[model samples]
Target: MKRDMRKTEREISKEEAKDILLKGEYGVLATISDEGYPYALPLSYVFADDIIYIHGAKEGHKLDNINFSSKVSFCVVGDTKVLSEKFSTNYESAIVFGKAMIIEGEEKTHALKHLIEKYSPDFMVSGLKYIENDQHRTTAFKIEIEKISGKARR
Candidate 1:
């Protein structure tokens, strides 16, 4: 279900939105808890081939929420500049609406590897070893993006 940006004038191209997603340092993943409350948490993620990859402990609140309902939203902010005098700020960001599917086996390995490449490029040797040793203790998610939109006040 794609929704139009409220501020059409501030909307950016899909390509630009993707660029922001790629360069973002971190993103907040939004999910619905079993209690019906919205749960949002910041996490390091990798955006690849139109899908977003995130990993976490196999058992926890986040995973519990995902298992309860696959629907979720993720947001990443690319850049910002405060305008204290104007009482506003210049910013660029992208939001993703998607269904999160837990991945395992080969897909999980690939996603984990991608995360390492993106966040721990300098520790690849050790990262691969870590994945091989403790992959079973962790879980990876693949977000099948249904709709994505970017906005900017630049």
Candidate 2:
């Protein structure tokens, strides 16, 4: 299969791409509904074991879209700064193509814990209690990455 096509010269290595994903605070997840409409939502996520984990309400448009179609795209932009004098911006970004599905049991709990670590490291005790209390109130999903590419303008 062919590799990334856009800005091939500026494409970064897999390691760089993964690094960006790990450090990114949020990402945009794109999905296609059953009616053929596309939807994109910005969400907080955790990158682990080469998979992307996201949590949300047990039911919603995102879940509906995922149920209708497994294919999805997620994008994360990092370290962006506008350079007015140069009329351009310096940035790093990564786009991931993958299949997503709701996870349950141990895997779901593990992903949730990872999220706590990433987002609330200082409140681990409270976070654990919160997870225990709300575990049934939320749903955790994992995206098994198929293809990912990173680019930079620095």
Candidate 3:
């Protein structure tokens, strides 16, 4: 599959791919709606134990799309710099293909904790409290990654 890339020289190892994923601040999640329309949205996420966790309002287009089909694609672009003189950009990115499912109870909490750790480490106490107060109003999903491909131009 690596040979399929337009520029195989930019293809990166799994470890390098995962590193870019971990450092990415936001990812674009792509899903197919019931009518076969494709929807893509940028969202905050947490990567833990090979699964990507995302949370949002319990009712929405994204959730509807997930219900229609579990298969989804998530893309994360880490760092980029435009090298005008070189007429190219240096960047690191990763794409993930996966199946997403709603997570509940302990699993949901676990995912939330990981998110807090990544985004609000300094406010752990308040984060925990906020989770308890807000968890019920939110919905969490875990994406079980089926295939991951990463590339970098450095």
Candidate 4:
């Protein structure tokens, strides 16, 4: 992606980066371990269609670094206000390069109910008592989008 004139040439349209990851909430998941080292976590995601849903705990360290490298890189950003210094840089960002798996039965309980109705839609009315007990204490995944790019700085 080397064509930088400070980079923006109108390239931010995978449904506008999935509507900024479905109205932007949180993102920053880059993983690589098994001694290769490089793990960044700050997740709370759920973007469908092109795939991107996350959840952890059934074990730690980002699921032992995606079970020793599933090669992932997910990102989402929207909410940066600094429109000055040449009148640009308000911000909207998305980056995804994926190959993460581990989603299990019933598509990991339907992607955790679409990540709880996209980050908690009023607790989804307790969704049948947390789908009959929090689907066995969290563990969901799906990155699949082998390529994605986005940008907006104004």
Candidate 5:
């Protein structure tokens, strides 16, 4: 990243960024469509290790877009308090960039389970339902981190 003092906020540690990504639950996913158009969609994600996992339909615009171009960007932001001022609003946000790859078989199954645990830990008791039934129908993709950066402001 360029050293732009104006764009930088309180630099968040890598660990803190990972925590935010893992716990934030919701994020926006950006992808390139077959027609060479940029597409951004709000999605729920799970962060494990250095990979961000997203679950979606077996067939749709997102899947089509990813298939056309593996390059993608994902971002997750934490709570923000509006600073009603004359100029602008203050906020905290985290962003990640990576190459997205469609995961299948065991990898996909594992990712799906991890996603469920992160976003809905309460349903863990019925974990078998996810491992067996849901896994067969849904699609999961992993974004292997090429780079990650986060910032926070008061």
Candidate 6:
């Protein structure tokens, strides 16, 4: 479903949106709990091959939510600042709606390694060691983005 942006000037191009997602430091993964409650958490992630990958413990609230429902949404804010004089904030952000699923084996390992490379590229030697030690205890999931939109106020 597509919604018209009230502020046409603020709508960002798809390429721009993809760039933001690729370079973003982190994003919030929103999920629905088994109890039908909304749960959102900030997470470190890596965007690769048109997929968003995140790593976490083998089990937790987020995992539980993903198990209960594959539908999820992710949001990343690029930059923001409060414009006190105008009483409006200037910001750029992207939101993605997608299906989330737990992945294992090589896919999981690749995602974990991608994250290590993104966040700890300077320490890859130890990063690989860390991944080797914690791989089994970690759960990696991928979000296949179905719809995405971006907006910005310059």
Backbone clashes under 3 angstroms, per model: 0, 0, 0, 0, 0, 0
Global lDDT of each candidate: 0.94, 0.94, 0.93, 0.81, 0.82, 0.92
**Candidate 6 local distance difference test against the native:** 0.92
**Clashes by residue pair, model 2:** none
Angstrom error at residue 60, model 2 = 1.1
* TM value for model 5: 0.88
RMSD in order of candidates: 0.9, 1.3, 1.5, 11.8, 2.1, 1.3
- Write the residue-wise lDDT of candidate 2 on 78-144 in tens digits: 9999999999999999999999999999999899999999999999999989988889999899999
Model 2 stretches with alpha carbons more than 4 Å out: 1-3
Which segments of model 3 are wrong by more than 4 Å? 1-3
lDDT of 4 by residue, 65-98 (tens): 9989888888889767876776766788888888
List the lowest-lDDT window of 10 residues for candidate 1.
Answer: 1-10
For candidate 2, the 10 contiguous residues with the lowest summed lDDT are: 1-10
Q: Better model by TM-score, 1 or 4?
A: 1
1-154, model 1: which lDDT tens digit per residue? 5656678999999899999999998999999998999999999999998999999997998999999999999999989999999999999999999999999999999999999999999999999999999999988999999989999999
52: Cα error in model 3, Å? 0.6
The deviation in Å at residue 101 for candidate 1 is 1.1
Better of 1 and 3 by TM-score: 1
**lDDT value, residue 107 of candidate 5:** 89
Clashing pairs in 3: none
CA error at residue 49 for candidate 3, angstroms: 0.8
| True-structure Cα RMSD, model 2 | 1.3
